[model samples]
Target chain A: MQVTLKILRFDPEKDKKAHFKSYEIEADPLDRILDALNTVKWYKDGTLTFRRSCAHGVCGSDAMRINGRNRLACKELVGDIGKKITIEPMLGFRILKDLVVDMEPFFEKYRSIKPYLINYEDPPATERFQSAEDREIFDETTKCILCGACSGSCPPFWSNSEFIGPAAIVNAHRFIFDSRDQGSDERIAVLSQSEGVFRCRTVYNCTDACPREIPVTKAIEQIKRVMLYNR
Target chain B: MYRGQSGMWLWVFHRLTGVGILAFLFLHVADTYLVGLGPEYYNELVFLYKLWVFRLAEWLLVGAVLYHAINGIRVVLMDFWESGVERHTQLVFGTLGLFLLLWLPAGIFMLKDVKWFA
Candidate 1:
């Protein structure tokens, strides 16, 4: 019938610091979390602010800390949350407002690893084609949508943000195992740097938070083993 | 090492400290190689090396080494020792405590002597 939502809100100027604000919402058992929040902002408080490019969890712009874990707001159901639902901005990022975190640092690390494929030669007149087996290796990695969920869930990134997190490494894996890419050695060399792949402790938090169900820890370890043998 | 687990964090810390040790090793070796760069460079190098910053770095280095060594033993025990399997987590904490025990006195001595080059 009714669920109490405790959301963390911070207005840099007005509040001067972060605090949790609670709101009551009445909705059906099947309503998505976004629907509940929308109901709250529409009728109760118009000052509530959060980012959502897609209400269906496709764009991943609604990733936040839901009940002490990193997840997309649109994906969580209000009925499923135990007791009280706690919403906060994603960890390990600069909170812009209520439930919104600046993801520039996460994107910077993604760009630092040269997330694009390093194709040595051009494709034919038509397009580049590959066997099913070859595509399978990188298929899971490509499912990542650059969401900051994994990086925020990582403990190492909490200590030192420079540690190229699992999200970036997973992006790199999409290219590292690409059959057309000729930069395996180059990517491995770059990753072997101090804060590169070696910084990963194989914590597997990335794998746990990945909504795409990609085998992130396995992919990172594969890159690690490549660096090891290649050296 | 997945979420809601213990050894996962420990393993991560161990490898991180391992990398820290490797970087320290490279820097230390490169600095020590200056001894062969003739006496004038060596004297200047030693003079600069014997500073408060260097002493602080030494303290951090000792901490890293102690962490790695103790964790490595935990790993080794996990690999060996018949009764160690059931007691693995306890062994990890025990050795980690041992490391702290050893590091505190070693650190005190280093600060008391106050000799960076020595």
Candidate 2:
């Protein structure tokens, strides 16, 4: 079967207007969206530029807006989405080309929360062992691959753009809940500043668009409860 | 502002109305409670209500209330088990649009000179 791909194109040198360009490709129902994109890039359009680290869904480099919804191209199969699909760069970021968004701002927000383990005590030489219940607190959050899908799917991030979005918040939670980490007080203090967790209105759009199906809203609500009780 | 997405837009409106109603409630209670001074204070507040500025405030208040109430019901429905799982988006905008159409004229006239709480 053939599917029509309406990919958003922007050419700084030639075309000033950003427009949708269409390409038809033949593929079976089981084929992943990445396979279709590769077919178009190799045979149909030489100028098409996109990013992919692993052909599988692990690396998360192929995250983009597919049919106006955030997704990893490698993870979506054409059979599930149907015969026609529209592709665009991820939202809430600077579009560098066809499907690559400037993720520097995304990473900057990640770093603003200080996304590393901060413990007042020294590490034990042995592997850190904790009860399964303690690790369960942040187990879902740690599955995030720094994908911009959650941030891109958020509307506050769309208008305000400066609010540290769910991706970073989830990353922060992964460490914040860890028993070994003693920096939650500092991190919560920092997050309580302007344009922080309070900006989220609980739209749950980020929860909807996340490829990993991470309970982003739950994480946000958990952090919000922490922030509320701390002060 | 992205078009053609029903569920997402309802989510956006839910977010806006949720915040809007909270802020309105804070301001409204403060204003109403001011009348506790007595009839003169209540009458004076009503007199303030008679003017164009307070009238404008009342109008926006009416709008915010209507939007919040209508959208809040939508939220309640979405929270329910059966009906929300399928018709979440359709129920939200369909009800909101009907609410606007049914109440627009009455709301506009009721906003003027008419004592909202009085």
Name the top TM-score candidate: 2
For candidate 1, lDDT tens digit of each residue in A31-137? 87888889988999999999888788779888777787777888888888754788888777888888778888888888877877677686679778888999988
Q: Tell me the tens digit of each residue's lDDT in model 2 across B64-90.
A: 667667766765554433345346457
Runs off by more than 4 Å, candidate 2: B1-7, B14-64, B69-118
Model 2, residue A164: distance off in Å is: 1.0
> Which CAPRI category fits model 1?
incorrect
Each model's lDDT comes to: 0.78, 0.78
Q: Candidate 2: fnat, from 0 to 1?
A: 0.06
**Per-residue lDDT tens digits of candidate 1, residues B1-51?**
124346566777788899999998897787789889887877787776568
Candidate 2, A98-158: lDDT as tens digits: 7878999889989877888887677889967789999988999988988788899888888
Candidate 2 has what TM-score? 0.74
Off by over 4 Å in 1: B1-118
